[model samples]
Target: MTRISTSIIYLILFFINVRFVKNQQTTNFSCEPRPTQADTTDKLQRLRAHLVNNNLFAYVIFSEDEHGSEYVQLYDERRAWISGFLGSAGT
Candidate 1:
């Protein structure tokens, strides 16, 4: 498929995934950084528990970059991956 069509398809799937995640997860997906921080922290706590079970003390988290790039690459879609925010401006 062409680039535009591919992007459109991805967008459609993104919305569907967002809906499913929002319903399944207690935290609502948001672009607001502060709100998402709490959500991420909660998730991290659960992850930390898993890590502790495996005898780990810490883990690294790489958040999405917010440079002035015109478009966000599929692989660098950390914001979408974490909080389900479709907008690139979201951190």
Candidate 2:
């Protein structure tokens, strides 16, 4: 009975430690400003031309949201346009 109780205590401590470590992890991510539409357009146009020359299809998507207000979406088109990565929370 004593050994069983000790095992349970160890299991509880292990779970608590796991939870604490998980909670301490940082959730922040940031990126540099995106490029202008003209820049993106120029790059996309070049990419499209290359694709057409190679007989390939090119697809692209850009998105942005307003900054400062969490209520608004930031303008992140340049980030996505150049990096091809999207922030789920618009950070």
Q: Which one wins on TM-score?
A: 1
The positional error of residue 70 in candidate 2, measured at the CA in angstroms, is 20
List model 2 lDDT by residue over 1-91, tens digit each: 5845755665666556655534443433364445732234456456656755786443323233444343334344555565455565322
Which pairs clash (backbone N, Cα, C closer than 3 Å) in model 2? 64-74, 64-76, 65-73, 65-74, 65-75, 66-73, 66-74
Best by lDDT: 1
Poorly placed runs, candidate 2 (over 4 Å): 1-38, 59-79, 83-91
lDDT of 1: 0.53
lDDT of 2 at 23: 48
Model 2 TM-score (2 dp): 0.27
lDDT (0 to 1) per candidate = 0.53, 0.48
**Residue 62 alpha-carbon offset, candidate 1, angstroms:** 16
- Candidate 1 structure, TM-score to reference: 0.30
Candidate 1, which segments miss by more than 4 Å at Cα? 27-91
